[model samples]
Target: MVTSNDLLIKQRSVIKFLAAEGCSAANIHAKMKTVYGEMCISDCAVRKWVRIFKGEDPREIILRDRKRSGSPLSALVTAHQEKVDCMIRANRRVKQKEIANAVGISKERVHHIITTVLGYLKVSARWVPRQLTVEMKAQRKDMCTQLLELSTVCPRMY
Candidate 1:
């Protein structure tokens, strides 16, 4: 249902006319239909290909892409990945939330960069309670073990 010739001749003709007459792309499209028997040219089509021609920086028509606004934060996000890795290397006790706060990004992003980019396996840390009663601490730890066991049993229960 598709073929390359749909684009090939139209592109060449647009470029050729743009180079020859110093005409606005709009005028060229009109002239093509009126003077050259090309009946299908539309204003929007001319606008689209004019961009391609401009992007090529033709020796004749020098067009530039419209300036894009508000670039993605990924471009400016400093790869504190090395810093996070250093922190992980120096002290396995630091929390990912703290690392994210220090790096000015989301905690999930910090976790992702550390685990995915740095190739560091997720680390397990011991949790200690200072003010909890013995019974409360035992209850909390029991709940955690139960959750982990349930995950293993069904792999999706928790």
Candidate 2:
């Protein structure tokens, strides 16, 4: 089935053609229901388009969709990011819903926190480990170097 967007595009094209043919708004709206079936463009929309075509140069009018402010990002889970991280660290197998329920936030917000701020993704339905901080990397390097020095000093241990 054609989506609402696709139907709008189709209706706009029809409106352009009807306008070029010098058809009235009422005429266009009347034909719309029969031509487009249940997805017919509303008469109010037809009237609006009629006004647009009448007052403005149709050729220069941009057919692009108007910009819209989409749904706002809810970051209620952000304060809980560290807590969630700790929980996951304690048990990587814990479910997102469980965490959300435990923390009292939407699972989607929890998901955003886990994947974005924490930089984690499910590996086999389990979150991938967060990236190590610079200090952690440095400490690990020093530990490996000390282990190498010890191995050299006591060769038999290798």
Candidate 3:
């Protein structure tokens, strides 16, 4: 699938090429409108790019979008996941907000890591593995079998 960023780059490249050929911004926008239709960028945006391409040094014409200065969109790196897992294992009843503060992430991300990534669930105010281990399964089966035998031996106590 062609992403919006890719489409923007395509349009920027076209703008640069047309500007190099001395085509006015109005003419370039008109041509792009016919080709891109509803997907076409605004005339103001076309004019901005045209001015950038025409005014800037020829060697500095960047077709790709520049990186912006801000916090990243996600902090779901493996280090953060590992830290969250360790914190949970160390204290199953630890709060998500505490984990987020310690791990330098958001509470929602910590919850996501615990429930989705680590396969844990909140049970009785504590974090527990969603799936039982083999030993736990066997222990439960043995207890059930013992109860069944006792109920059969003492039918009146059922």
What are the RMSDs of all candidates, in order?
Answer: 12.6, 9.9, 4.8
Considering only N, C-alpha and C atoms within 3 Å, which residue pairs clash in candidate 1? none
User: What's model 3's TM-score?
Assistant: 0.67
Ranking by TM-score: 3, 2, 1
Clashing pairs in 3: none
For candidate 2, report its TM-score.
0.44
User: What lDDT is reached at residue 156 by model 1?
Assistant: 59
Over 111-136, each residue of candidate 3 has an lDDT whose tens digit, in order, gives 88888888999999899999998999
* Residue runs of model 3 more than 4 Å from their true location after superposition: 56-61, 71-74, 97-109, 131-158
Model 1: per-residue Cα lDDT over 1-158, one tens digit each: 33445544655566556845566777777766675464455667676666656565444543333457964544135567677767776777778888887777778778667666665555358222225668999999999999888899998556
After the best TM-score superposition of candidate 1, give how far the Cα of residue 44 lies from its true spot, in angstroms.
2.7
RMSD of 2: 9.9
Global lDDT of each candidate: 0.64, 0.81, 0.89
Q: Rank the candidates by lDDT, best first.
A: 3, 2, 1
Global Cα lDDT for candidate 1: 0.64
